[model samples]
Target: MAVPRQSEAQEYIEKQRIMELFDNITAQLVFHRPDNPKTFMIDYVEKLKESRTTQLDFPCLFDESNIESVFGMLDPTKKGFITSEQYKESTQTLGCDNVDPSPAGSDMDMITQDTFRREVKTGLKKASATFEQV
Candidate 1:
């Protein structure tokens, strides 16, 4: 088989890692909006800026850049909003060509990734510590 280009390998690694992160974010993301859309957005933003996992190895919860990227995850157009219809459409093509912009809105259907994210962490305390350091 032909060797994959260096950039290709790097891209693969990064994609795999971020996809895993997205899976984890989905867990909290689901509970995020149950009561209030306004607070949910603020809460979600805070969670990203401030990691709260018990493990320390995962990405920092609130890395502004990652949070911003997460904000743009589904918004290729960069409009900064997602709707229920747009949310549902994303699940059909995750891990395939279907999920191009990465569904900036929602992905509860792909909870398998959430499981992976939890497994990667050791404890909420440890995870929280990691977020504070940054």
Candidate 2:
């Protein structure tokens, strides 16, 4: 979409935040260096960036300031990242958290590191997937 202009301050800010999150995630995933995996989570941001052909996407939120929206949608309390307990709560709320892969499945939701990237895609928009449906 040509990138929303400053008039859409809200939109611009949100995109920036999402990008920041993507960068943070990209760095983290790069650190872990998981084995050849089909899905993301460990490589969410980088994969998405490659998938989208742009460095402006995150798996956490579609918008930056709206990251809390994800917390609300997934976590709700705004306490921050998902821990074991918080993950359970997120599963109940997100329902689809199970769609992610978790070899351990001990995290209460059968979610593995791969799930984070899939769901975060919920909020991101790559030039390629922009026309995609939810």
Candidate 3:
């Protein structure tokens, strides 16, 4: 018996997650707002390729600024903190299923920006490690 081969489109786009590649590219473009988008994208893609070849994904390219933006969107009033519920919902929405919504060594009801960033960083690292193992 012979195994059937997938169509080129399915093999590349579905198996390789091309849509996710484009989505991340677009998100980075919006975040950076570079003067020359074409060059920026080329460089970005090159770095992504390098990271993949090295078996590293760099935590989905989320930087301090991106974390800050997410915190700001959740807090809205610059309150310096958000409720634990908000943190949980946002993390889940961001596909961080393994992250604990409540920050460690803090009141379970509220999460500060620093705490959120730290927890998210830790979680992303763990998630990346898990992905590499798979």
Mind giving the per-residue lDDT tens digits that candidate 1 earns over 32-52? 435665575566546655544
Using TM-score, give the best candidate's number. Answer: 3
Which has the better lDDT: candidate 1, or candidate 3? 3
Off by over 4 Å in 3: 1-8, 33-35, 53-62, 65-82, 92-115, 122-133
lDDT of 3 by residue, 6-76 (tens): 68657656656566567777877887899999999898777666666675555365667988899999989
| Deviation (Å) of 125 in candidate 2 | 4.3
User: Model 3, poorest ten-residue lDDT window?
Assistant: 125-134
**lDDT assessment of candidate 3:** 0.70
* Clash statistics: count for each candidate: 11, 6, 0
| 1 or 2, greater by lDDT | 2
Q: Cα deviation in Å at residue 29, candidate 3?
A: 2.7
Candidates ranked, most accurate by lDDT first: 3, 2, 1
TM-score of each: 0.26, 0.25, 0.53
- Which structure among the candidates has the greatest lDDT? 3
Which residue segments of model 1 deviate by more than 4 Å?
A: 1-16, 31-33, 37-42, 52-134
